[model samples]
Target: SKFGTIYFWRVHYNDSSDHVNETFSFRPVQPGGGGGGMGGA
Candidate 1:
């Protein structure tokens, strides 16, 4: 998770014809209540 920072990602797909058929994208995940805490320290 990130500290409320804007993140972007994308994935491209192509066929055997060497043509880009589609493009997929999304914003992975968000931080928790502790502002992005990890395993118990």
Candidate 2:
């Protein structure tokens, strides 16, 4: 798996007219990417 990567998802409806949509994002962490493991190395 990759690290420090971001992913997004969205949905669209209708034929270029009125539509509903939503957006979301997230990132992956390597257990202790911020601290703890390996002295935050």
Best by lDDT: 1
In candidate 1, list every pair of residues with a backbone clash: none
Estimate, for each residue in 1-41, the C-alpha lDDT of model 1 and write its tens digit: 43322231112222323333321122232233132432221
The 10 consecutive residues of candidate 2 with the worst lDDT sum are: 4-13
RMSD of each: 10.8, 11.0
Of candidate 1, the 10-residue stretch with the lowest lDDT total is: 4-13
TM-score quality measure for candidate 2:
0.13
Clash tally, candidates in order: 0, 0
Local distance difference test, each candidate: 0.26, 0.24
Which ranges in model 1 have alpha carbons more than 4 Å from their true place?
3-5, 9-23, 27-41
Clashing pairs for model 2 are: none
Would you estimate the TM-scores of all the predictions?
0.15, 0.13
For residues 7-30, what per-residue lDDT tens digits would candidate 2 score against the true structure? 111121222232322211122233
